[model samples]
Target chain A: MRVLGVDPGLTRCGVGVVEGVAGRPLTMLGVGVVRTPADADIGHRLVAIERGLEEWLDTHRPELVAVERVFSQHNVRTVMGTAQASAVAMLCAARRGIPVALHTPSEVKAAVTGSGRADKAQVGAMVTRLLRLAAPPRPADAADALALAICHIWRAPAQNRLQRAVAAQHAQNAPKGRTA
Target chain B: MRVLGVDPGLTRCGVGVVEGVAGRPLTMLGVGVVRTPADADIGHRLVAIERGLEEWLDTHRPELVAVERVFSQHNVRTVMGTAQASAVAMLCAARRGIPVALHTPSEVKAAVTGSGRADKAQVGAMVTRLLRLAAPPRPADAADALALAICHIWRAPAQNRLQRAVAAQHAQNAPKGRTA
Candidate 1:
């Protein structure tokens, strides 16, 4: 499956697309950052991010989109900007009927570097080796985006299977067409 | 100016439109809530919100759109959802080229009830009195939405003048071919 991962931010949003399946080496379809001026109004910045995401969606056409799940931060302003940018990414995928998944930073780190506590450098190194690239992607956010895509690509299958099994069990226990 | 106020939330988003100038009596053009099931997927929920806000914008065609500024909350998940919904509201207004404003909760309370620390009931009462309605609007979120519209209507004139004064001062100090 081809997956697009987004590391959402107001000033600089990282975007990367990877094509791969279980037990297969992934191919880098594209990677880049979408930037908006810091001095611009919040609404205008959001619009710019939306336009950038739409362009990427049109050009790459990834099957799935993975976005970083926003968590609380000490800096309320920074967190708000990140959350806003993250929403735009999800909305872009939804508008196109593309499935979107959210992965926490820790989950991405664990998936890519075998540790939830892995630092940015470790995650970047692992991503480089996994993608067989000559060097790690620059601008930490770009590498982080690739890690998110790899995490979702590796985790989604197992997650989907688990969901289906739970749904089947619930269906068997339900009475008539109603869920208990 | 006509203003549409949005109180963004994941499960229940309140939307209201009011028409008036700073010193004139405001007319309530419309007021309602957009609700999504808690069990729905996040992407679907966001799309539902985007569609709902877009419909409101198209129908009301307000000159200004006012959204409640999301603040950091102790609950990370709740804050994330609110921030996401708030972004969608801004995006809708920006897409239509409608000027958008964000009012903090305290600012809305202060403008409507004369106190930033006023409770929800007090704000509701003030909104009801300001709109000359027999009763307060149902659901606190709906009343808060109206309060936001009122706050923006009352504050925007002063804010605009201040901005223009700053621009004028900068223009006078700038070089012939550039702005400071």
Candidate 2:
């Protein structure tokens, strides 16, 4: 499966694309940051972000988009901007019929670095090792985006298994020939 | 000027359109809520908001859009949703080339009533009075949206004066005839 991960922010939105499945090697399709001027009006900033994301979506056309789930416990100002940016990212994907998945920062870190509490450098190092890149992606946001994609790709199998088990349980609970 | 006011929210996005100048009695073109099911996914909710806002814009073609400014000091979860919804509202306006304005809750309340800390009922009462309606708009959110449009209309003259004053000051300070 191909996935595009977004580390959403107003000033610099990090985007990365990875193609592969669980229990197999992954390929880094692309990585970049969409930067908007801090001095621009919020409306214009959102429009710019939308255009940038649309370009990424058109070029990569990933089957799924993974966005870093925003939490309110962070710095209040930063959290609002992040939430706004993520909304634009999700809107762009959903408008085009692409599925969007949200994974928390801790989830991304834990998926790649073996611990949710892993530091930035640790996550970067592991992403580099997993992707077999000579150097880690620059601007921690970029590396974080890659880590998010890797996490989504790796976690899909377990999530599917859990979903199937739940479905099977529901099916067993129902009477036969109830299907309409 | 015609203004479309948006009180952004996840479940019920309140919207109102008002037309007229500050000194003149304003006309209420429309007032309603754009609702998305609370159980809907965030992306789908945002998309729904976008569609709703676009329809309002298409119908009214307001010269300006007045949206409530989101602050992070409020309930974290609610604030995040508000911010996301506001982003979509602003995006719709900006994408259509309509000027976007943000009014804080305090500012809107103050503009409608005499106090910045006016309660919902007070604001609703004032909105009803100003619009010359027999009854206040139902749903506090709807009233609040009308109040926002009213606030922007009332504040525009003062804002324009301030802008002109600043521009004159700059022109005086600027080097003469560098127009080449």
Compare the candidates by DockQ and give the number of the best one: 1
Model 2 CAPRI rating: acceptable
Cα lDDT of model 2 by residue, A1-180, tens digit: 788999999999999999999999999999989999998778778888888898998899887789999998879889888999999998887665566789999999889998999999999899899998999998889999999999999988666355345434533653322111
lDDT of 2 by residue, B1-180 (tens): 788999999999999999999899999999999999998768767888888888898899887889999988879789889999999998777665566789999999999998999999999999999999999998999999999999999988767455345434533653321111
Off by over 4 Å in 2: A158-180, B158-180
Checking candidate 1 for backbone clashes, the offending pairs are none
- Report the C-alpha lDDT of model 1 over B53-117, residue by residue, as the tens digit: 87888789887788998889658889899999999888777655566788899999999999999
What is candidate 2's local distance difference test score? 0.85
**Using Cα atoms with residue i matched to residue i, what is each candidate's TM-score against the true structure?**
0.88, 0.88
Tens digits of per-residue lDDT, candidate 1, A68-94, equal 998886689999999999999988776
